[model samples]
Target: MKINGEVTTGLGKAAYFLSQEFYSLEFERNLGFVPFPGTLNVVVSDDYLDEINEIKNNCQNLIKPDEGFGAVKYIPAKLCDEINGAIVFPAKTTHEENYLEFIAENKLRDQMNLKDGDIVSLEF
Candidate 1:
């Protein structure tokens, strides 16, 4: 499956959470690379809302977090047909249905030269 969306800014909280040892260790073990301490926010186009919801509901590869944090489900994905990443669904996220969070080994914004409103494609 593939989806395209415009990049958006997030609340700037993921870095702190992602940097925690528990989560980073799990990500390294499961994803083969430790995620860059941040996420790339993509607001899915309205046309793909239903498909995004379907993936959210059906995703089973979960990363259980430590106490005080929430579990997250993730689907392995590729960004722009090049970067290896994952589409993450945090159980306690404040985001709406159209929002998709991506994590990769490198800081994607710099690596991809991304900014708000830039179009990015993810393939699962």
Candidate 2:
């Protein structure tokens, strides 16, 4: 499946969330890589809202957080057809439903040369 989106800025907490041992370890187990200590925030196309909801509906597992930590879910994804990653949804996230947070083994912003407003695509 494919979803179109535009890169966007986040609340600047991806590094903190990604660095937590609980999230890092769970991400490695689920996505096959310990993601770079950050995420690529994307504002998905409005047309893909249903698809995004479907993914959330089908999510059977949760990345349960340790005490005092927030929760998240992992959804497998491929970014720009090259980087392997997972879309993460934090339980305490401030983003809207159409906003997705992607975590990969590499620094996606640098690797893809992405900046705010850059269009991107994701495959699941």
lDDT of 2 by residue, 39-121 (tens): 89999877888878888878876898899888787788899898888888788877898899988999888888999999999
Candidate 2 lDDT at 45 equals 71
Badly placed stretches (over 4 Å) of model 2 are none
Taking all chains together, the TM-score of candidate 2 against the true structure is 0.93
In model 1, the runs with Cα more than 4 Å from the true position are: none
lDDT: worst 10-residue window of model 1: 51-60
Candidate number achieving the greatest lDDT relative to the actual structure: 1
**Predicted structure with the largest TM-score when compared to the true one:** 1
lDDT of 1 at 39: 98
Provide backbone clash counts, one per model.
Answer: 0, 0
Q: What CA RMSD would you report for each candidate?
A: 0.9, 1.1
Measured on C-alpha atoms, candidate 1 has an lDDT of 0.90
